[model samples]
Every structure is written in structure tokens, then in C-alpha cells.
Target: MTKLKTVVAMAAASALFLAACGSGDSSGSGGSYKLSFVQGVTGDAFYITMGCAVQEEAKKEGATVDIQGPQKFDPTQQTPVLQSVVSSRPDAILIAPTDVSAMQRPIEQATKQNIKVVLVDTTLNDPSIAASAIASDNVGGGKAAFEAIKQLAPQGGKVLVVSVQPGISTTDARAKGFQDAVKADSKFTDLGVQYSQNEPQKAAQIVTAALQKDPDIVGIFAANLFSAEGSATGVRQANKQDQVKIVGFDAGPDQVKALQDGTVQALVAQQPGKIGQVGVQQAIKALKGEKTETKVQTGFTIVTKDNLDSPEGKAALYKSSC
Candidate 1:
């Protein structure tokens, strides 16, 4: 009888040990998850809004999230931040890769450690390693920008694109889409694209120079928020506000103000918060061993002065903080 009691106690202890081990798997089935969100850069209203949504969604899933981002939107800066996050061994990571190629290996490292990775906002050249990639339809957004320009400058004349650096998936796609659409229409002359290196000052300089070279340039497409800000500044500095109609991407508060103040003609607003919220959902699904959509494309809103005060426009604007 004594021996039988001892055996039974050992069997119970073994079962409890196995249960504890299974609960540590980070599988959401039995344990809370730890999630990390790495943004393209810190201090951008777009990313801030996304981060806020990520936190909110993670809370709903009973998971905790830590948000990190580089000061600049550069692969070199983002890699170190990612590596540090990977070392912390979070159950999942949602990141916006700064460069399509440069960020590939660093993100792969996270996946190799068995941490589920979801690409948010921007993606890599090879995105297969990530559990999911979620972002706005940047290419379509770019084409829409051209359409807005066509409407603003109905007669059609010389046009230029102010874009961020190449190899950035989002901006690159936007530039390509706009250029392709411009080519399709013979009425407009493509003055080609200029890289802003993600600097509003550089974008301003590029715009001022381009305007000087082609004063008759009737339309301009600024591919991102900073580019839009600088393009408006450049148009103002060159005193071409009345001459050049501008269509910009991303509707931050400043961009909205620019539209209302007539600094820009129209704005392409992406659903950044939705992307973040969906990113968290996908990561949680991946952790729970559930099916996830490999590639999810969110929609955009066109914000003009006509709809600046509308419900849709207000909902589309990015938040500065949570």
C-alpha cells in the first residue's frame, strides 16, 4: 500500500510538470503572449498611430506588447533595434522593414529563433519568412494621386514626383504606380522622380530646384508625409502655389492642415491603425497555430478640403499618440 501511494504521487507530479511545460509555449491556447512592434521610425504620426492600435489589440488578446523604433528610417538603425528586440525573445514581432533587401536578414534572424514575424507597413524583398505582411495599397495610392493631379490640373502639363529613397518598398511602389499612370496618359509630361532621402529639407530643395527648372510644371506628387510637407514648403518658397497643384500621400495632422490651407490639392490617407490592429490579430493567430492571411492589403482614403471635416476624413487621419 505504501509503495502504491508513492507511485501515484510521482505520477501526479509528472503530469503537473508536463502541464507547466506546455503552458510556456507561448501558444495563446493556454498562456499569455509577449509581442513586440518595431516601427520604420519613431516620432512619425503614422507609426505612432499604428503602435497605439497594436497596443490596444494586444490588450484585447491578453498579450503584452513592447514598441520600439529607430530614430531614422534607415536599415542600419533599424537592424540594431530589431536585433535587440529579437534577443529579448518575444513570442511575436510586427515590424516595418526600412529597406526591401537590407532588412531581410535581420528579420530572418527573428524567425530562426522561432519568433513569429509579421511585416507591417513595409515589407522585404523576400517576405516568405514572415507569417504575414500587412500594409496599405501604396501602388494604388500612387495611381490615385495621379488621378487627383489630373483632376486638379485638368489641362495636363509637366508633372514631377517627390519621393523617399529607393529600395523602400512603400515609397518605391508609390513612385512606380504614379509614374506608370503618368506614362499611360500622354497629356502629362513626366519630369521623372527625385529622391528625398526621407528628409523634408532635401525634398524642399528638390522641389525648389525642379520648379526653377520647369516653372510650367503644373502638378506634383509627393509620395510620403515628409515629402508632402517639404513639397508644400518648396512650392511656397518658390511662390508657385497658384501655379503647381500638389497631390500628397498620407494624411497626418500637418498634411490635413496643408490640404485645408490649400498648400496641397489632395491627400492619400492610409489606414495605419487598421494595419496595426490587423497585424496584432495575425500575430496572435500565428501564435495560436491558426491560419493567417499571407498578405493583407488595407485601403486608403482621399482627403481633400471638401471632405476634411467629414467623418471619413477624421477617421482616416493619423494620431500623434495613443
Candidate 2:
């Protein structure tokens, strides 16, 4: 009977302890189910879109989610957030690990108490703590970027990589895949990878610096929406828009404008709205003691002017999501 009650207590977590889930304090009203959400940064439209999806799912599931994260993709900032989340001892935690290795200890601590941890939008180095991880096919997405730009520089010119956080696994994987694809193809010449750290001004600064180093850089890879916009700006400021091709990951209103203007040749867009719905579905499965897939690939697709508003493109952004 005691064991059964404990099982029920653990299972009923979301409903019984809402505050602790995200508050970093175990004390709560009790029975009000809580969830903790630690993200990279909410400012980026991509992460913001992802958070919206998670929040929507939490609402539908009637689970209280405290979503907190760094303003930028800084592990130093998110580390304390993770620690505070562990301190709260919530029923579960949804984290987008900024640095997979740095996050191991906190996740391991939560595991010791049988608390649930779900990694969304990113992954961890030690995958043991997260019951499941929902993310885009980052490597595949990067490959798509390389394929799109290969034609522009068939003979292989310099390609500058503009990115947000340099250490994040998702960005790293995508960048690596893109570089590998270019390297494997003898026709391609690799430039180098640079960091924007997801800051618009920073991205532009880095792009400007990269351009100065390689005046003939044929392509620029923006690893996310913000960096993509900045990349376009950098190209234009240098009077090289028509000469340089820019490919971006993720999309928003600004990215759309860039695409239409022919500044951003293409974008790798992921469904942010669906990411929210999927997160809810997985959480419910966990609540019901049902088996869930360890890694659910949310997926990403290439977006270009040719398909910007086509039925297929609209369909991708439709269905109540990104």
C-alpha cells in the first residue's frame, strides 16, 4: 500500500505540486502539479516559437510549467537556472541543454529523486536523465543547407558560417555536417566557422570581420533566424549581396522578407507550433506510464522563394504551428 501510494504521488506530480516544478523550491500548495522549463533563450524567435509550443501543450495538459532560461545562449546563465530547477524538485523538468556536458550533474541529481526530465529543442551529452528528447534533424538540416549552396559555388569558394552559441550541440552538429559535406565534395572550398552568439549586432560584426578576411566568400551559412538576418545585413553593407549567397536555419517574418527580397536564398524551417503539441503528447505518455520514443525528430524543411507561399510551403507553416 505504501509503495502504491508513492507511485500515485509520483504519477500525480503535475497536478499536486505546480510551483516546485519551476520555482526551485519544494514547498508548494501540494497537488497542483508543476513542470520546470529551462531553455537556451526565449528571445530568439526560434526558441520563442518552441516555448510557445511547450506552453500550449502545458495548458492543454493542465500542468503548471515555469519556463525560465538565459536571455542569450550562455551556459553560465542557464546553469544557475538548471540548479534552481533541481532545487525546486518539481514533478518534471523540460530542458534545452545549453551545454550538454555541463548539464549532466544537475540532471543526474534529479534522476536520483525519480523526477522526470524531458529534453526539448536540444539534447544532452549524458542521455540517461532525459526520458525523451524532441528535436529537429540537425545534421540533416545542415546537409540541406550545403546542398542548396553547392550549386552557387560548384567550383567551391569560401563559405562563412554565422552562428549563435558556439558550444550548443545542435548548432555544432549542423555546422559539422555542413562542413563535412563541403569537404567531401572536392568542388567545395571551406572558409571557416564564426560565432554570432545569437546577437544581431554580434552576428553582423562577425560577418563583417569574416568578409574582410575573405573578400571572395561565395556563401554564408546562418545557423539560426537571427544570425541569418544579420548575415544578410553584413552582405549588403559590404555591397556583396548579389555576389554572396546566404542560407539560414529557421524562419520568421524577417526571414520571409529577406527571402522575398532575394537576400536570403533559402531557410531551413522547423515547425515550432508542432513542437509544442508533440511535447504535450510525450508528457502525457510519461504521465500514463506509457513507453515513449527516446528521440522524436520534429524535422526541418528547406524554404526558398520558389516555394515560399506554395501550397506545400503554406502547408508546412500551417497546421497551427511555425
Candidate 3:
């Protein structure tokens, strides 16, 4: 063949090779994969950071990712959003389920469609639907939050736990951890775990009631961001800032501000970004027919006034943006 004709033939062959490689497939191809990340709630710093991390990691893997969630952390609201995600038929889904049992059917349905599922940050009742679950050691973090409270109020008095409503695995675990820790310590008397349903106002009401019942309440553990915010508000409202030691979960902006202003003594900060990163990583692996750890435990840090300005503490701070 002429030199010009040979060059054209080589160019055509190269185009065909690239096309074959770029063909989207679940069988270990490096081509783009469709992924969806369903947050338990939108506009929350933890979920925002998780979404950012998932997008960042998906970019590296050439996967297209969409992050969607309910306006609030309600399973009824989240189920429709999840159904929409499933209808899109993405190759994989990484989700933070609002309820363990409520979300089971939807997640199992996705699995039935042959979509790989990775539970991020929170889990469902039937984890068998998920290929992997990546989240902070919530139980350990809860125990740590109580430990901080103990350090603050060593002479143990009545303590209250403000938590998101029942059925949220993460907060439930944290509450349990706090209860177990309290049970192990005779110094602290448990006031009871109050459900806020992720509403700050409800949490504040509970805290105020607890304070009314036992004005000598020494400490409080807020199980998540909204609960922490409400607990702080309650403490401020009751004018018990100096009297009540408050340890909270998640270092969101409000929680960090509370820590700085002495409303909250310490915060159990979960590595939500790390959870998202691992969720995407596991999803990719599962899609590629590679083995993945069914349970991946991310970590947490305790942020306090002492370390709020430190490098490690700053790293634990949550970001509102991707």
C-alpha cells in the first residue's frame, strides 16, 4: 500500500481500538460507569462532604456519579428518591439509608436489578442487599463522646442523650454506645435518650424538659448534628452553659461553633469524606468482579477546645461544599 494509505489504515485501526476500550461494560473495563450516591439528607455538611469525596474518587475511576437525597432525613422521603435513582439503572449505588427496615425493600430491589450497592455512613436492617457498608465506628465514637463528658463532669450527675429518632442506625449505635458506657460507670445517672427526629426544636424541647426535671444534670450527649445544635440551644436557653457539660456527635459548623463558644465541650467527628471515598472504591471493585470488604470501618476524632486549632482537629472539620 502507498505510504498515505498505510497511515490512514493505521489511524482507523487506532480509532477502533479506542472505541472497544471505551465501550461501557461492567466486566472490568476502564470505561465510564454510572454511579449514584443517595444521601440520607441533603444540605448537611456530612453528606455534602461525602458527596464531594465520592465525586472526586469517581473521577479517578472514570465513573459518572450523581448525588441525590431527601430534603430531610425521613425514610418516606428518601424512598422515592432512591426509587428514582434505581429507575436510572446506574451500575452502582452508594447510600446512607434513613431507616434500617424502611429502606430494606428498595435497596434489595436495586440488588435484584444487578446493581452493586454500597452502604455509606448508615446501614439498613438487611445488610445483605449491600455489597459493602462503609461508615465511622459510631459505637466507638459514642463511647468516646460519653468518655469526654465523664472527664468534664467527673462527679457524675444526671446526664441526657439527645438523638435523632429511632431507626437511624448511626445515631442508634451512638446512643447505645453512650448508654453502655454510662451503665459501666456508676457515677453518671442516665436521664434517658430523647428522640429529635433530626429536628433541632424537638431536641431543644427534650433538653429543656430534662433540665426542668433534674436541674442538676451534669452532662449531655447529642447524638448527631441537629441534635447537638438543639442541645446547645437548650443549654443556652436554660442558662446552664457553665453547669452542664455537653458532648456532641459530628463536627458540623454549628457543632464546631458550639465547641468554640463553650456550649459543647467536645465533638465526636466522623470521617464522612473517608466513608464516601471508600464507598466508591468498593463499588468500583464490586463492579469489576473484584472482592471487597463487606464491612469497612472508617474512623472518628474527638474535637475539643484544646485541639480545635490543631492540624488533626482542623482536618476533622466538616465542609459545606464539594
Candidate 4:
């Protein structure tokens, strides 16, 4: 009888342990709701900060949020992660798609399964697949970037933009914004944009070539972090730090450091954490059959050396981890 009692007690304890483990899966106060946030790149500070905010915000709404992403910011790398997330059949998905066109089909699959999709940071080609698109105003960021360049190069000479691959919504908007902003003023000569394909070395090569071609180039706008890093390196290598005005996008640690050291004069910083927080909030709302906003345009912060340590500047910084 004592052996029987011991066996029964062990079985009960095992059951309790199993239940505890399953609690985190999908069981919440208002029933189970699972949210998955796919980052553009796992190691990227912007995406990490965004993922952290999404996880915390989802918890507040009694939902379990999972973070998934590729090691590299490539559409092919992201596709498998998206497919896996869909297979999990989460209540909602918040994703930063690598490419505008490549992500459309994967997002469509999620929508077909009734999974609420909230696009964060980046967007897809077809906006209809998403319940809501929450991101910084990339065009505005781009315009701000050029305005900084204008201030640096008051006389306005030849200016270049180092950008990532084409068809990536955020960078594309930024490039367009810069171009349009330049068009309004005839003083600044547009030297044309160079595609980096998210490769820093390639961006560096492009910048080096541009500098060699246009030694009189007055300003450079780097559309993303990698491009900015490469541009800074290129400018420093060419010994044109004083002559070239470098304006960068995304206040990642490297960019902030660049700003501090005068590698980049200014940064058009996106509110990635806010975007993530809002993305999860909107996803939860969609799951609850609430009216979610079709578009949520989070604004950007212009960070410079003067205000680098200020509260606002600190807010603009990105974290590598939650």
C-alpha cells in the first residue's frame, strides 16, 4: 500500500510539472493567444530592442510572444522562419520583412490561416495582407538626413547615398526622400545612390569608388546601419572626414559611436522599440476582434553629438539584447 501511495504521489508531481511547462505555451487568462515577432536579424540591435518590447507588451495583454529571425538580413533566410512561424499557427505575427516582394507570399499564407499579421519596421509589397503596418516614417527620416547634409554643406556640392538592396521598403523610402529633398534645392548636386545589398564591405567599396570618382562630393547619406558603417570607413580611409558630410540612419551602437567620434555628423533614428510595442498591441487587438489601425507611422528622432547623452538621445539608442 505504501509503494502504491508513493507511485501515486510521483505521478501527481509529474502531472503538475507538465502543467507548469504547458502554462507558458498558449494558456492565458482570456484563453490562449500566442504572438510571434520576427526580427529582421537576430543580432541587430534595432530588431533586438523591438523584439524585447514586443515580448513585454504581449505579456501585459496575457499573450505569449516568441521572437524569431534569421542570423543575416536576407529574404531567403527570413522565408523559412516565416514558414515555421506560420506552421506554429500563432494567434498573430509581427514581422520585419527583408524584402518587399519576397515576403508577400509568406505573409499571405499567414493571413489565410487567420493569423493576424502586423508589419513592423519593414513592409511587404502588398499592404492588404497585414492587419496593421507599424514603422518609422522612412521618407521623413530620409528627408531629415538630407537636411542635415544641407546644414553641413551649406554651399551644397555633389552628394551621394549609400543604400541597401532595392525593393526593401524602409531603405527605398529613405533614398527616395533624400532624392526628393535634394530636388527641391538646386544647390546640392545629386551624385546618385549606390546599392550595397546589405554588405558592409561592398558599401565600403562603393563609397571608396564614389570618393575617387567625385573628389568634390560634399555629403553622403547612408540609408542603413551597414551602409553607414562602410561609408564612415570609406571616408576615413580616404582622409575626407572634414571635407565630406556624413549623415547616417539608425542609431545603433555603431552609429552612436560614429556620431560621438564625428564619423557621422547626425543620425535619423527610428523608434524601433516603440514600433515593436505597438505591433504587439495591434496584434492583440486584432485577435480580440478590436478595431486596429491600418497604419501606425512612428516618427524618428534626429540624434547628434550635442544631444548624444540627453534623455531624448538615450531614447533613440538601440539595445543589443532585452
Instruction: List the lowest-lDDT window of 10 residues for candidate 3.
Output: 4-13
Tell me each candidate's TM-score. Answer: 0.92, 0.83, 0.92, 0.90
Best by lDDT: 1
Give the poorly placed runs of model 3, Cα more than 4 Å off.
Answer: 1-24
Against the reference, the lDDT scores of all candidates come to 0.86, 0.72, 0.84, 0.81
Better of 1 and 2 by TM-score: 1
lDDT of 4 by residue, 169-191 (tens): 99999999999999899998888
| lDDT by residue (tens digit), candidate 3, 198-232 | 99999999899889989999999999999999999
lDDT (Cα, tens digit) per residue for candidate 1, span 1-322: 0000000000000111011111146456666899999999999999999999999999999999999999999999999999999999888899999999999999998888888899999999998888888888888888888888888887899999999898999999999999999999999999999999889999999999998888899999999999999999999999989989998988888888888888898888888898999999888877777777788888888888776777776888899888
User: How well does candidate 3 score on lDDT at residue 46?
Assistant: 91
Q: By how many angstroms RMSD does model 4 differ from the true structure?
A: 14.6
Against the true structure, what is every candidate's RMSD?
14.6, 10.6, 13.6, 14.6
After superposition, the stretches of candidate 1 with alpha carbons farther than 4 Å from their true spots are 1-26
